[model samples]
Target chain A: MTFSDITIHAMAERVITYTGYMARWQPDARERLERAAFDLFVEQGFASTTVPQIAARAGLSTRTFFRHFADKRDALFADEHAVPDQAGRIVAEAPDGITPLQIVASGFDAVAAAQFSREKSYYIARHQIIQSDDGLRERQLHTQAALVEALRSGFVQRGSDPVDALLAAHLTATVFSVSIGRWLSAESTEPLATLLRDTFDRMLRTAAS
Target chain B: MTFSDITIHAMAERVITYTGYMARWQPDARERLERAAFDLFVEQGFASTTVPQIAARAGLSTRTFFRHFADKRDALFADEHAVPDQAGRIVAEAPDGITPLQIVASGFDAVAAAQFSREKSYYIARHQIIQSDDGLRERQLHTQAALVEALRSGFVQRGSDPVDALLAAHLTATVFSVSIGRWLSAESTEPLATLLRDTFDRMLRTAAS
Candidate 1:
C-alpha cells in the first residue's frame, strides 16, 4: 500500500479511543476535543493533523473546536495562558510580610495541589507531544518566560531590591522548571508538591553555600 | 520614494564604519566580519540582510565570511559554544574541598574577567539584535539551557548529590542570566563581576531565610 493509504488505515484503528458516536453531545466537549486532538497528533504528527480532523474525530463541529481553542497550538496549550495571571494573583494575595522566596514556594505548593495532582496524566501527554514539535517547544519557552516575568513583578511589588528580585524570580523559575522536568521525565511516584518542596530546599542549601 | 526604493537607498547610506578596503586583509578577520554583520543587521534588519551583503560590506569574500562564521545567526553567537566546556574545566580544576556553589562562583568570576569585561559593547549590541528575532530568541533560550546543563554536570562532578547539583547549577545559571540581563538592560556602569557577586550574595540571604 501507498504511504497515504497506510496512514488512512492506521487512523481508522487509532481513532477508537478518543472518539465516540455520542461524543458530540458530551458534557466535557473541551476534554473530548483535547483527547481527539492528542490522538490525531500522536498518530499523524502535530504538523500533519488539521483542526477539522480533530473536531471530526471528536464528533464535534469545527465551530465547537474554535470555541474551545483559538487554533491547534492553542489546543495543545489551553491552560498555559493562565500561568502568569495565576502567579500574579498568588503573589498579590500573599501576606505583606512573607519573603519573596516563600511567596514563590506558596505559588508552587498551590500549583501542585490544585493543578498537577489531578492532571498529571494530561501534563505527561502534553509534554510528550510538545517535545515532538519545535514550534510547541518554542511556545513552551515563552510560557516559562512569562512565568519568570510574573514572579519578577511580584517580587518587585513585595519591595525587594531590583537585583534581589531578579534572583528571586530566576530561582523560582529554575525550581519549577527543574522539578517539573524531573517529575514528568522520571518514573517516580512522588507527588509534585513534595518534589517541588524538596527541590526548593536543596536549592536553598546550594544558594546558601 | 517607494518602500523598496527607500530600503535600497537606505542600505546604500548604511554601509559605513564596518567596511573598509583593506579590512579583508587586516588582522582579526573575524572581528571585521562581525562588525560588518552587526552593522548590516541593524541597518536593514537581520531577516533582510544576506551573507553576501555582510561579506561585501566587510570588504571580504563570502569564503572569508564562512571561515569566520557558519551563518549570520552563528555570527551573533560566536563564543557561546565554549561556555559548557570552560565551565567543566573550572569544575575539574578546583580543589576538592571547594563547594559546588563556590566552583560556580569561580567560573562566573573567570568568565566575567576573561570575556564580559572586554566585550561589553559587543554583548549589548548582540542582545539587541537577538531580541528582535523570534528564531534568535529561541536560540538564546537554547544557549541558556545548555549553560544550565553545563553547570548541573559540573556540580555533579564536584560530588554533590543529584538534587543539590540540580539546585547548584540552576543557581549558577540564574545568577549569570540575571546579572547579565541587568548589566545589559540598565545604564549602570558596574562591572559584570561585581554585579554577579552581589546577586549571589543576595540569593544566599534569601535562600538562608
Candidate 2:
C-alpha cells in the first residue's frame, strides 16, 4: 500500500478507538463523581462538601460534575430515579393472580435486589450522610414519594382499583422504609429482601389483627 | 357595707373580667394570624407572601405573629402538632380488647372529628397552598413522620412489639393520608371520619386478601 494509504488507515483506527472511549466516558464520570462525593460527604458533612472539591477528587472538571449531578446533593442520590423504575417494572411484570399488596412487596424485593444488594457499606454511609442533613432527608422523602407514586401508577395500569392501588403503594413504601431502617441499623444482619418480606408479613398481620 | 368591703369587691370583679379577656386573647391572636396568612397565601402564592404582610393583614404586630408561629409558613400548620397529641390520647384510652390497628383507626377517627370536621374550606385552601410550594410539602412530610413516631411510641408504651408497633403506626399514617386525600378531593362529599373508616376497612381487606 502507499504511504498515504497507511497513514489514513491508522487515523481511521484511532478515530474508531476514540469513539468507543467517548461512549464509555459518561457512565465512568458519573460513577467517579458519586464515589468522590460520597467519600467527601462521609469525611466532612454533606453540607460542608462542595461540587468543585468532589470533581477535584474524582479527577474530573466542574463542568463534567454538573453534567452528572445537578448539585452536590444530587450526587448522593444519583440512583434515586432508578429505584421507582425498578419497582414499577417488577409490579408490572408480576403474575396476574397476586394481590396488589403482594405485587408491591415483590416490587420492593426487586428494588432491593437490583439497587441495594451489593452496596452494603456505601448504603450505610449514604444513610448516615442523608440523616445528618435536613435537605438530604427532604430529598430522600421526595424520592420515596416518587417511588410510591410510581408503584401506585403501576398498580392502576394493571387494572387494580385506584384506592386499593394508593393503599398498596403507600403500604409498600412504608414496608420498604421500615426494612431499610432495620437493614441499616448496626443490630441487623439479615438481608434487605428478607427484612422487606418479613416487614410485609408483619404489616399484613397487624392490619388483619 | 363598709367602704373597705366595697373596694375589695370591686377589685375582685375587675380581676375576674381581666382574666376572662386574657384567656380569650391568645387563641384570638392565633386564629387571626392563621386567617391572615391563608388569605395572603391564596391571593399571591405561598412563596410571594411575607410574614410582615400576614401580620399586618391580621392587625397584629410581627412579634405577636412570632409568638403564635415560628415562621410565616408555620401559620399554615398551626394545628399540626395537635393531631398526634389527639391521636395518642385516643390510642391510650382505647379499650383493652381493641387491636393495635383498631386503636390507631379509632385515634384517627377522633382526630378527624376534633380537627378536620369543622375546617373543610380552610383545609382545602391550606392543601392548595402546600401543594404549590416544595418547602411546605417537605414540612408536611416531616409532620407526618413526627406523627408516625408518636403513634409508634404510643403503641410501644401500651405493650406492643416494636416491629409490630412500627407497622401499625405506618399503616395508620397511610390510611390517614389516603382518607385526607379523598376527603379533600373536589368530587368527594363524604366526611373525613367516614373516609377514614372506609379506608381502614379497605386496608384490612386488602391485607387479608
Candidate 3:
C-alpha cells in the first residue's frame, strides 16, 4: 500500500529521534523494516498485522517500506534471499578440483556464516512463526526451491554434469534445511556454520551406510 | 464445487454406457476420475479445466468427484497421499536392526514399486505440468514435506533420535525427489524402483566424496 503524507512526516521525525541508535548499528531501512515486521508478527500474528503498522513500528514511511519491500511478507524475507545469492557466489568462485557436492556444502557453510551466525534468537523466533502457519511454510518452501535452483545453476556453470548438479543441489538444500532445524533447537552456543558442516558430514556418513 | 442433480443422473447413464470398459479394468470411480482429470489437464491447461467436465468425462457424478478429490488440482494428485501412507506402513513393519535411513530408503522403494511403476507417461506429463506452474510446485513441496514428516514420525516411533530422524527423513526425501526426476527423463525402460536404488547409491557416493 502507498504511504500517506502524514505518516511520511511522522516517520521522518521518528527516524531523526532514532538517529543515535541508527548510527550505532547502521542498520539500513530494509533491515529495520524487517525487524519491525517480524516483531509485530510475533506479537499480533502475521495475519493480523498490516504494512502501515510495520512501517510505523520501523520508524519509516509507507513509501520507504514500499521502497524496500513489496509487502509485509516480503519484508519478513528480505534477508532470506541473500543466503542463496551468497551461496551461488561462493560456489561460482570456489577453486577448481572440488566435486559438485563439495561446492554445495562449502557454499552452504558460507551462507550460514554470513547470515545465520549473529541473529540466533531472531531467526529462532522467525522459524517458529513460519512453522506455525501454512502460508509462511509455503513461502519458505518457495524460498528453499529458489536456493536449490541457484545451487544447481552454480554447479552447471562450473561444468558439472547436469544430472549430478541437480542431485548435489537437492542434497545440499536438504542438508541445510535439516541443519537449520537442529541449529534452531540446539541448546549450545555452537555456530551455525559448524552445525551445518557437522550435519553435512553426518548425513554423508549415514547415506553411505 | 458441489454436483448438480442433472449431472448426477447424466453420470449414472454415462457409467452404464461404460460398464463394459469398467468391467475389463475394474478401476474404481476415484481412479477413473483421476485419469479423466489428468487427460483434461493435459489437453486444456489445469487452470482452464472445470470439475463438472472431469466428472462428465469420467462417467461419474460431480458428487462422486468431490468425494474422491477436493478440487481439480486434488484430482491430479489423487495418488500422491498414498506415497506417505505406504512409506509409513513400510517403515512400521520393517524387521528389527535396520537403521532409520535404511528404513526410509526401503519405504521409498516400496512406494515407487507400488505407485510409480505403472503410469510412466502419465506421471511424466503431470511432472511437467507441476514443474511449469508455481501453484503445483508449492503443492508438490507440501506433499514432499508431508512425506518427510511421515518418515520422521516413523523413525521416532521406532525409537530413533529426533534430530537424527529429521536428518534421515530429509535426506531420503531429497534422494527420492532427485531419483524421480531422473526416472521420468530416462530413455530406457528401467523400473522406477531400480532407478531410485541406483540414485540412492550414487547420491551416497557423491556425498561421501
- Top candidate when judged by DockQ against the true structure: 1
User: What TM-scores result for chain A when each predicted structure is judged separately against the true chain A?
Assistant: 0.81, 0.84, 0.81
Q: Report the error of model 3 at residue B168, Å.
A: 2.3
Model 2 chain A worst lDDT window (10 residues): A11-20
Q: How many collisions per candidate?
A: 0, 0, 0
Candidate 2: lDDT over CA atoms? 0.81
Query: Scored by CA lDDT, what does every candidate get?
Result: 0.78, 0.81, 0.78
Task: Provide the lDDT at B130 for model 1.
Answer: 93
Comparing candidate 1 with candidate 3, which one achieves the higher TM-score?
Answer: 1
Candidate 1 scores a C-alpha RMSD against the true structure in Å of 5.2
Ranking by TM-score: 2, 1, 3
Per-residue alpha-carbon lDDT of model 3 for B45-148, expressed as tens digits?
A: 88877787787788766767787788888886776788888888888999889997677666655677687767788788998878776678778887887989
Candidate 2, superposed: residue stretches over 4 Å from native: A1-27, A107-109, B1-27
**DockQ score for model 2:** 0.55
TM-score of 3: 0.80
Name the weakest run of 10 consecutive residues (lDDT summed) in model 1 chain A: A12-21
Q: Mind giving the per-residue lDDT tens digits that candidate 2 earns over B35-102?
A: 98999999989987777667666666666777889998898888888888887888788888778887
Q: Model 2, residue A201: what's the lDDT?
A: 90
User: What lDDT tens digits, residue by residue, belong to model 3 across residues A141-197?
Assistant: 878888899989998999977767787888788788777877788575777778788
User: What is the Cα root-mean-square deviation between model 2 and the actual structure?
Assistant: 12.8
